[model samples]
Target: MELPKDPAMLLSIVNMKLRDFYPTLTTLCEEMEIKETELTERLASIGYEYDADGNQFV
Candidate 1:
């Protein structure tokens, strides 16, 4: 699936999915058909990174 083009929106969507659905970034990427590196890179551009312990991008 195509994610939001805007980083902030992407952060919100991904974080929500993380909070409500996925157990890990890896799981989310696999089930959602997203690239781990690409998602991290996009969110990193906005100064957010995945905290595996918290299971969210903070």
Candidate 2:
């Protein structure tokens, strides 16, 4: 799937996927064929970081 280019949109979509589908960021990245580091960095650029305990980015 093509990920959103905008950091804010990417943050929202990824968090939603993490919440509704994947149990963890690792799973989400694997299933989506995305690199976990890349995804996290992208979100982090926008001031979001993965909260493993909550399974979402904050």
For residues 1-58, could you state the per-residue lDDT of candidate 2 as single tens digits? Answer: 9999999889889988988999999999989999999999998998888999999999
What TM-score, computed on C-alpha atoms, does each candidate reach? 0.95, 0.96
- Looking at model 2, residue 55 earns an lDDT score of 97
Give one digit per residue, the lDDT tens place, for model 1 in 11-45. 99999999999999999999998789999999999
Candidate 1 — which residues are off by over 4 angstroms? none
lDDT for each candidate structure: 0.94, 0.92
Q: TM-score: which candidate is best? A: 2
| lDDT, candidate 1, at 24 | 96
